[model samples]
Target: MAMMQKTEILIIGAGVIGICAAYYLTEKGYKVTVVDKGEVCSGCSYGNVGVAVPSICGTLASPGIISKSLKWLLDPESPFYIKPRFNRDLIGWLWEFQRACNEPQMRRGLSILHEFNTASVELFKDLAAQEKMDFGFVQKGLLVVFKSLPGFKEGVQEAELRQKIGIEAEIIRGSELRSFAPHLRSGLAGGIYYRRDAHLDPYKFVRRLAEKTRKKGAQILTSTEVIGFEIFGKAIKTVETTRGDFTADEVVLAAGAWSSEMSRYLGLKLPIQAAKGYSITYRLPENYLEMPVSLSETKVFITPLADTLRLGGTLELAGMDLSINKRRVNAILKTVPEYIDINIENLKLIEIWRGLRPCTPDGLPFLGRCRAINNFIVAAGHAMEGISLGPVTGQLVAQVIGNEKPSVDLSLMSIERFN
Candidate 1:
């Protein structure tokens, strides 16, 4: 066996969570090493609708989503679809997800998510200001446009609920919608404007952060796949990877959708499922979208990047597959012309990307120490909010490793919450 390399802190998975954790830990003067099966930000962190929305408090497991998912199941082009499978884990997760849809659980999940998202967005702003890492971060806010009265009514109710919970939201209708967002197509019923929301170029953000971390003396080993771990008593003593064995005083598992498989080495059952999503980037049109807009009725998010525009939506519960679904892509493309003055046929495709988001049954991320392994921390399960919550998750990981109190309550993020 080759002699194991050593570091003060070792992070698995070089996606948003792992990279952010590495950056923060390196800043804290820790000898950090980040290893991933693929290159940095090459996974779910890239190619997402880069909207930094802190005003969204509702979980994906919220009420009505189950019914919505059922209706979507029959349509291949639906915004959310679940492949029929006999996997026990998927079955268990669905049941728990269904149970978590009630008022009490939704409120509890939203409370934690709301606080984390608010703090994370501020942290992102601070990172941009302090580091001058320009990833086209914009704070122009997000517009959720509804074409039908029913959807518009739901938007109003959601806006009111968000307002009650200290989130900045406003309902814009008719003339105001036209004047405020002249870029949008005519005949929209109404829309909800979340003033606290923002958008950015996610690809640039992740690559830049990785570069910055390397400059600060953090070791990032891409294509280094972790295969096993050496556990002693209640702690991980060493991690065995395809490259070589490595030893770290502290280990963090932020492997996103792959964490469930990795956790087995430590005798842990992490109830995480891979929710597949797709995004298509196009060269900016002559009249590109001025800001981030979510087609509320279709569930597609249109985000304006520097030189391109991205349209992304759809959540498929079809375990770790990167294959593109043309129907889902078409569904997203079809929604564009209804809300805006863009013809899908005329757009030039820059890229088509698909990624699997790590999702927990309850819609809350698993953050903090593992019960079976004292030195190991799990920070996966952010689902669609990985980019939005990256920095704060990193900050929390650093605080946990430094033996300092976390900025927010860690009870909700407990790894053993399912147990």
Candidate 2:
């Protein structure tokens, strides 16, 4: 028999989402306990680019993405790939994703994401300003550079869409682009600058925030994996974990990539697919970049932290696998020289990381209370926007649990929307 503990609120997963949720919930005077399968920030939160950009509007399910993905399917080193599999969930997710690959759905998702990101950016600014909370937060904005004319054209169109949605985007070309990003290679098409974007060291941010949450009377139990849930009449009665059993008044599932599997314990089907992403970190070279840069054509993002520079991108739907694919990693590495004038041959390699990003069919997160389970709330499926929108997602989760109106309208992010 497992020993049982009680808490006012229980949060699963100690990544950015769960830790942020714990931060806000503790702030709201809720007795919170957060548990994770591993140490805090040990998952995707540890190695992401850590960019918080409001200018990112287009989602993975945007129009023409199907065609682009079809083309990428032939190449093993493409930026996006869905591993060949005969799984029913993948098929169902693909079907829904196909339906969402249209103009209207994309626009709707873009609007929601922009709103979430904008609010989260403000929260990040606040968090960075707090005493003893330093995570290398920099608001120098982001530059999306294009090496090809076609890619630049599409980038401009994206800028136009962002402009129409009230996000500030400036399109620069030739000498102007070169001057804006002096480190770029010559003969590049141009770049678009999003002034509202910012970045930080993701690992430092998550770890520091976890420490702060712990100091705020929240119990953070790492190395505790949730194995099963005892549901009693629409409420989770006991959350059985490797450590023991925990009974809370409310439960939150912010387990990132594992949320789908965990939800099955509750007899709920969450249409979240774990999309694997890779990142390589290296020692910061001399005269390093001040702001993050996105290689528009290659889909890679370069972020310079305090002492390290990171190159990260690529989305592979390979289902929870953390194995690094050299071809895909090389695909990201080989594109750096083509876009930037940097010579990475001499740069000291640090670490190569792979993480599974939880993705929904429509590219938006599932972030609300379940209709059938009153005490159950989900804050997962953030896809690539988890870092960008983590704080806002946490605040909203707390609001929902407190029976307060969510700051952002979560109608589209319904937990049971796919049902």
Against the reference, the lDDT scores of all candidates come to 0.88, 0.92
> Candidate 2 on 266-366: residue-level lDDT in tens?
99999999999999999999898899999988899999999999999999999888999999999999999998999888999999999999999999999
Any runs in candidate 1 off by more than 4 Å, and if so which?
Answer: none
Encode model 1's per-residue lDDT on 1-419: one tens digit a residue.
89879999999999989999999999999999999998999889988999886886557888878787788899888888888989998998888888889878887777788889889889888989988899899889899999998899988987887788889888899557878887778888999989888888888888899899999999999999999999888888889999999999999999999999889878888899999988999998876656899999888999989989899999999987778988888888888889887777888999988989899988889999876688999899998899998999999999999989999999877898877
Compare the candidates by TM-score and give the number of the best one: 2
Would you list the clashing residue pairs of candidate 2? none
Candidate no. 1 TM-score: 0.98
Q: Per-residue error at 393 for model 1, in Å?
A: 0.4
RMSD of 2: 0.9
